[model samples]
Target: MQAFDLVSKNISQIIPIPIYVGVFVVLLFQVFPRIFIARQRSIGQSTANRPGKDSDTPNGIYDRKPSLSSLVTPDPTFSWRDNPQQIPREIKPGKYFLTMNVRKLDFNDYIIFDKRYLSEYRERQAIISNVGSARIFVAEANDAALDLCEETLMVTVDFLVTRYPSMFHRTERGVLCVDAGEEYDLVTRPWVRHPLETMCLLSGDDCILMRCCNDGVLRVAAVGLVYSLDIDWTSFVGKDLASIHRDARIPFYESAIQKSVDRYFLKLQPDKPVARANWLTQIGPELRNEKFPDEYFRHVSTIPGNTITPETVVDDLYFRVERQAMRKLPSMRGVVFKFHLYATNIWDLELEEGVPRRFAEHIRGLPESVLRQKHCLEYVDCILKVMDLMAERQEKNTTNFHN
Candidate 1:
C-alpha cells in the first residue's frame, strides 16, 4: 500500500499544475481574442459586402448609385429668349394654357401663407385687406420655372431608367405625392414621395420648367432653376403601395423595379430628411418580413456607410420656415401657405452636429443648370442657409426658433 501511494504521488508530480496553467493562458489571451476578431470580421464582411443581405427578403428594392457611363444631356445654348427683358404681368394663381414654349399643361396653384404675419395682425382688419394678409410671396411667373423643373425630372428619370433598366424595368409606374409622415409601409401604408419640388414635367417631348418666387411677384427671371426629368410613380410602381410590393414579391427583374424606384427618388429627394431623424424606419417592402435581418445592421463601432446611426436618430422633427415666409399674404380667413416649419433640437440625441452642412455641400454640387435658376436658386440657397444656421446654432450652443 505504501509503495502504491508513492507511485501515485510520483505521477501527480510529473503532470505539474504549471503545464495546465500555461495551456489555459494561451487559449484565453492569444487564441480567444483572435477568434472573436475573426468572428467580428466575418460578420462585418457578410453584412457590409452582401448588398441586400440585410434585406429580410431574398428579393427586395434598394438604392443604386448612378454610374459614370450615364450620359449627360447637352444644355441648349443660351438664347435671348432664355430670359425675357420685360417682366411678364403678374399672373394670378389660376389654371392657364398659354404656351410660351413647346410644353404646356393645366397648372394648379398651391397657396402659401405666413403664420407669424397672421398672428401679429390677427385683429387688424384694415391692414389684412390692403396687403392681403401680411407676409406673402407668390410664384406668378412659375411657368418658366415649372417648365425647367419638369424638363430636368424627365431627363433624370429617363437617364436612371435606361442606365439601370434592371431596376426600373417593370411596366408598372408609380405616382409622386407629398406626405407629412416619413416611412414606407408594405403591409398597410404606401410609399409616399414628393414628385415635384424644384422640377416639373407637362408631358413627353415637351420642354418642362419650374420657377421659384417670393414677395408679391416671382423673384428673378430664369434664375435658381433645377433641371431633371420627372417620373410618374404609378407607371413605375403600380397604382398603390400594395400592388407594387405584391409584384415585387415575385423576386426577379420586376422586384428590381423597386430598386430602381428607390434609387431614382433618392437622387430626386437628395436633401430629404433622414427617416431616423424622427426615429422612424423608412417604411418599405423590407419591413414586411416577419423577422428583421439583424445581420445587415451593426452596432456601428465606426461611422455607418449607408444606414443611419441610432445616436444621430432624431426623435424630434424640425420643419423649417424660410426667409421667404417674410412675404406671407393673409387670406380671407388665414394665410395662403398653410404649413409652417416646425423644429426641435438634434443635440438632444447625443450626436455630433454639423450634419446639415455636410448635406448642403453634397446638394450644392449637383449640375449647375439645376442650381443656377433665379427663383429656384433663391429658394435652394434659403433652405441651405437655414440648414447651415441650424448647425451653427447647435455648435454655438444656442437656441433656434422659427416663427
Candidate 2:
C-alpha cells in the first residue's frame, strides 16, 4: 500500500492530469465522428460496388408505336371547289333558310349564329361557327328553358364528330376536332350538351352576328354581297412572315422579354456608355475579346392603376427585356418577369390576413370570360406578368427607335 501511494504521487508530479483529459476529450468530440462517418460510407460504397444482382432485367415492356388499324382508316374525299353548297335547295314554308349574303369575310373572321333555324320535323336550336375563310363549320346547340329568355348555349363538337366526321382530323400540325368534352372542362356537365372549344372558332376585328338553327346546322354567311380577295402572285415572302409573327405577337411572354435585348449589345462597349447615350455605338475592347459579364439586365417600372394601388400592393409590373446575346438576332426572343412588391407600411396591413378581399375583387373584375371561369391567383399573376412584359417591350422599343 505504501509503494502504490508513492507511485501515484510520482506520476502526478511528472505530468499535468487536467491537460491530458482535455486533449482526450477534444479528440473524442472533434475527430471520431468524421472518421466513423468516412468508414461507414466506404463500407457501404464497397458493398454497393460488389455486383448487380441476377434479377435486374426488364422482361416484357410493350412498345408504344401506332398500329396499322389506327393509321389506315378510310375518310371521305371531299374537295372544297368541286363540292357544291350543301345547304337544302328548297326552303319550305315555316322552315327558315339560315342564309345571309355577307359582303366580305376573311381567314381570321368569326361569325356567330344568333338567329335560330327552324324545322317542323325536329325541335332543336344550334349555333353555327364559320371559322376563318375555310369551308369548315362548327355548330353549337342551345335549348330553351321553361322561359325562352332563359336559354342555355351548348357547343356542337360531338354533333360535328358524329354528323360531320369529315370535318375533323389529327393533322401534322394539330388536332382539328372540337372535342370539347375531352379537351376542356366546360363541357363536362350533363346540362351542357354542347361546349365550344376556343380553337374550333376563329374571329377577327369585324362585325359579325351570332346566329342559331333548329336542324342541328348553323351558318354564318356574310351580310350584303360576298367579296373574295385573291392574293397577287409574288406578294408573299413565305418564311419572313414566320419571323415577323415571332417578333410581334407570338403568344405568352417570351416575345415581350426580348424587346430590350439590344441593350446587351450596347453593354458590350467597355467604356460603358451613359444611360442616355447610344449603347450600340460603343462596342468596347472586351467585346473584341468576347468577354462579357456573367449576368446582365436592365430595369423598367410602371405603377398599377388606382384600383390595385395599396400601401403594400402587388407589384404587377412587367418588362420586355431583350435576349440577343444568347443567340442570333432573329432567334433571341423576349422574356417577361412578373413579380409583386409588398408595401411594408400601410393602414389595413393587418387586413391582408384572410383570403385577401382585394385579390378576390381583382379576380372578380377580369375582362375575359374564359379567364374568369378558371379564376386563380397563379393564372392572374402569370397573365399580368405577360402583359407587363409586352408593355415594357413596346415602350422600350418605342424609346429606342425614337432616340
Candidate 3:
C-alpha cells in the first residue's frame, strides 16, 4: 500500500477528528493556565517572606543585635584619680612586723594626703624660697636629667596649684608661687631654677625622678633631694634602682624587694598612686651626707661601734621612716617617687602608745638575712638592748595597771 493512503485509513478508523481537537483545547485552557497560576503564587510568597537589606538577619543562621557597649562612647574624665579610695591613716605599731599578715593594698590608696600635709608643705616652701638654703638642697641637673626634671616640676606645680589653691598662688608675672607670709615664686625664683627645684619648693618630700629607658628599666634620671638619710644624690642620679642599691652591704638589689619594686614601677598607672613605709635608724636628723661614702659597703665588712653603739642606738639614734609614693605622669610617661622623710627619736617610741612593744617585736622578728641586707646586724646587739629595756618598762606598766 501507498504510505500516505495507509496512514489516512488508520486515522479514520482509530478516532474521530473532533475528539482529538476537543482534548487539545481543554489542555490549553485548563491545565496550562492552572500550572502558570500556581508558579506565580509560589514566587509571590517567596518574595513576601524574604529578608530585606535592612533586616535583622544574624551573621550566620541566627538574628543578633549590636551590643550597647559598642554604641556608646567612654567618659574621658572618669579615671583612677577622680575618686581615690581611703587607706589606713594610722601608723599601726605592728603593721610592718616580719611575721604579720601581708596587708592587702587597694589601688586607690596609693597617694595619701594626711594630717602632715600642711606642715610638710610649709617646710618645703621655706627651704626653696630662701636663696642660699635652696642652693645647698638642690643638685645641679645633668643633661640627661634636664627634660625629666622640667616635666616633673611642671606636673608637681600643676597638681599643687589645682588641688590646694589656698596654699599656692599664681602671681601677675605668670609665676606659680607658694603663699608663706611672703609669696615665694616657685618658677622664676633664682634658687628655684629647674623643674626639680620647683618640686623642692612645693614639698618637703625628696623627689627621686625616674624614667624608663629603651632597656625597659627605670633609671633615676634626676633628684631634688634635700634630706637623703644615707644615699648620695650625685651617685644615684644615673643608675637604675637595682644598680643604685647594688653596693648596699645587704643583698637588697638581689633580694625579693628588688623584684617587687621593679614590678610595681612597671605596672604603676597614672591614676593610681601607691605609698610604702620603710624605717631605718639614722645617727642624727641632719639632711647632709652624714653617712659614709657609697664605696663604704665595698670596704667595710663589719658594722662599726660608732655607727651603732648602745648610747648611740638609744640616745642619739633617730627612727627614720620614709613615706614613699610613686606616681606616673601622663604627659611625661615617667614615674615620680617622692620620699617624705619623717624622723623621731628612738625614745619617742616609748611615748606613742604600744609603739615601743610593737617596734621591739618587729625588730626581733626580722630575719638574720634581712638584718644583714639592711646592714643592721652590726647594731643588732645595741638595738636588742634598747628594745629589751622598752619591753621591761612595758611589762612593769602592765603589772602596775592590773593592780
Clash totals in order: 68, 32, 3
Top lDDT: which candidate number? 3
The whole-model C-alpha lDDT of candidate 1 against the native structure comes to 0.29
Q: Model 3, range 12-101, lDDT digits (tens) per residue?
A: 889899988899999999999999999988876775566645632211211112321232333323332334322222344432333211
lDDT of 1 by residue, 298-346 (tens): 3332454656432233222222211111111111110111112222232
Who is ahead in TM-score, 1 or 2? 1
lDDT of 2 by residue, 334-377 (tens): 11111111111112222223212332343345444323222222
Best by TM-score: 3
User: lDDT score, residue 261, model 1?
Assistant: 34
TM-score of each: 0.19, 0.18, 0.60
- lDDT scores for all predictions? 0.29, 0.26, 0.57
Point out the worst 10-residue segment of candidate 1 by lDDT: 325-334
lDDT of 3 at 145: 57
Alpha-carbon RMSD, candidate 1: 27.4
Task: Report the C-alpha displacement of residue 403, candidate 1, in angstroms.
Answer: 36
Better of 2 and 3 by TM-score: 3
